[model samples]
Target: MRIAFASGKGGTGKTTVAVNLAVSAVRVGLGTAYVDCDVEEPNGHIYLEPEKDLSLPVAVEVPEIDESLCTVCGECGRICEFNAIAVLGDRVMVFPELCHGCGGCFLVCPVDAMKRSGRLVGRVETGVSKIAPCGEDRTAPGGEGEISFVQGILKVKEAMPLPVIREVKKHIPDRDIVIIDCPPGNSCPMVESVRGADRVILVTEPTPFGLNDLEIALKTVREMDIPVDIIMNRCDPDAELPAGAFDDGGARVIARIPESREIAEINSRGGLASLESPEFARIIDKILEKILRAAREARR
Candidate 1:
């Protein structure tokens, strides 16, 4: 079963929930793998702290024009939808960054002047993290089990992150459960991260900005025909939602992590909030039960 934790915007404790859920799943004797798909700024490693075992570079194909074989034809430029190539009278320019690596320019070149070249976009790393059971120190020996970890690190200043996110997901182990820590937003990165998830949990605060983005993310996810559940992080009883925010959508609030300074402090110190907080652990356990139940039903 693949469960993805995502948020419409940053700082809603998306990664916090994802990491703890993976650990909690492992504590219950489930083989779990945590994949961080937020390639642009992946920080789940800070919590998992896995000892990496494999590192692979991810590259994308970009057009490399061979001037010697070039007729300076404008066919390549016209075929590129992203304007990655241009013909300037006597010269041809190829902008690798602008290219989507679709190889359209190569197919359109009449003289075969376009050569394929690779640009290093990012890298995928895989490792294992030993996580202790709930209420136990993770650093101590005799931990319950190990959680496989896979994450992507996109090269700085890279415009395209989908390729890196795809690479990270390719490393997902064949575990009983997989938890994806998605990028914060309703953009392509977040969508790509949760594309194949069996269930999606959107974490949001009670603020207006949080709810606003949540509605957008919820609608988008629903359009993709994926099952969605919302986790109200830092819940405030007095907080009010925007009108019709959750009315017709099948998405519902499945859990709420109430406002607590202790939760914040634990997470701030790079500790698993669920490991030390019994209340938090119980919440996670409930969510895990729901996920497992859904997965079993799907299997049936």
Candidate 2:
């Protein structure tokens, strides 16, 4: 089963929930893998601390124009919606950063001057990590077991992240459970990360800003027909949420992590909250149970 943890915006405890759930899954003796799809800012490795085992470069196809054989007919420029290829005077300029590799330029080239080429955008790193139960030492041998780790690092100034996200997902090990930590927001990168998830957990806070973006995320996931639930991070019981917060197409609030300074401090120190806080551990277990139940229901 593949479970994706995402947020409407950054700093919503999305990665916190994802990594802890993966570790909890491993602690329960399930074959598990943690895939960090936030290529532009992947930080799950900081918590997992997996020993690096492999690194592979990820590249994307871009148009390479051969000016020598070219007739500046402007066909390639006209066909390109992203303006990746343009004819300026007698020369053809190709901006690989803007290219989506849709083959529009190649198909519309009347002189066959456009050729396919690769642009290195990022890399995928795979590693192995071990996790123990909530109370046990992670480095101990008795109950600890290995979990596969995969993350993508996008090169600076890269305009696109879907290519690197796809590359990272391709390395998801066969496991009883896989948790994907997706980039924040409801953009193309977020959509691609949650594409085939059995269940998606949208983490948000009970605030005006958080709920506003959460609505957008809910719509995106519903449009894709994926089963989704909401997790309220730093939830305050006294704060009254807006009326109709759960009305219409909104997802149910399946779990809530209360506001805790300890959790914040632990996370700031690159420690898993579930391993340090008993209350946080219980919340993770409850969330994991709900996720497992949802996955089973989906398969049925």
Candidate 3:
């Protein structure tokens, strides 16, 4: 099963939930993998800290102008939806950054003046935790664990991130479970990360901003026909359960992380919640149970 964790806004603790769930799953002896498909700002690595095993550039096909054979007919410019290509009387300009790598300019060139070239968008990196050191857990020393990790990192100031996100997802195979740390917001990048997911865990807080954004994210995920669950992070005992809108979505609340100084301190230092807070194990266990149940349903 492939599960994605997403949110409508940033700083909703989406990565925090994804990393912990993946860690908990690995501890349970499942063949699990974690894919940080949030190419724009992948932070799951700050927690997993897996050793690098593979790295590759994720490039897209952009139009390459052949000035010698060019007619400067505006056809290439007309066909480009992203305004990436422009043709003047004697000059052809190509904006690689603006290009979505659709290759429309190459196909629409009447004089065959447009060719294809690779434009580096981002990169995909894979790493191994405990699985690489030991073939099986029993043979390894005590306290050693296993988990696979992958992440997509977009180039600075690059507009197109879908290709990188797709490349990262290609690492995921049919497995017991794969946790995806998706980009926040209801944008194309977030959609790309959430696509093809069996289940999506929406992480949010009790604040008005959190609730409002959660609703927006739900609309997009619901359109994809993917099962969704909610995790109310930073839930304070003194505060009321501000999940009425979430309740209306009809998705189960798998977990609620109470606000505490220990969790805050650990989180500030980029620590894994599942590993740092022993008191939160009960909540993590319940969340893992729901995640496995969703996977089983997907199998059926």
Score residue 91 of candidate 3 by CA lDDT: 86
Residue-level lDDT tens digits of model 1 in 116-203: 8999999999999975443333332333488899999999999899999988888899898899999988988989999999889999
Any residue pairs clashing in model 2, and if so which? none
Q: Give the TM-score of candidate 1.
A: 0.93
Query: Global lDDT of each model?
Result: 0.87, 0.86, 0.80
- Model 2 weakest lDDT span, ten residues long: 134-143
Residue-by-residue lDDT tens digits, candidate 2, 1-300: 888988877888899999999877877667889999999999999998999999999988898988888899899899889988878888999988899878888888888999899999999999987644433443323334677899999999997999999988889998888999999989999999999998889999987778898888888888988888988989875544466745764577788788999999999999988878988988998998888887777678
- Residue ranges of candidate 3 with Cα displaced over 4 Å: 131-144, 237-249, 297-300
The lowest-lDDT stretch of 10 consecutive residues in candidate 1 is: 134-143
Candidate 3 C-alpha lDDT tens digits along 1-300 = 888899887897888778777777767667778888888888888877889888999999988888899888889989999988877888889988888887777777889988888888889999876522333432333323667889999999888889998898898755567888898888898898998988889998888898889888988898988999888888864444454555665577778888788877877898877676767756776788988877777678
Q: For candidate 1, what is the lDDT?
A: 0.87
In candidate 2, stretches whose alpha carbon ends up further than 4 angstroms from where it belongs are: 131-144, 237-241
* TM-score for each model: 0.93, 0.92, 0.90
Candidate 3: 10-residue stretch with minimal lDDT: 131-140
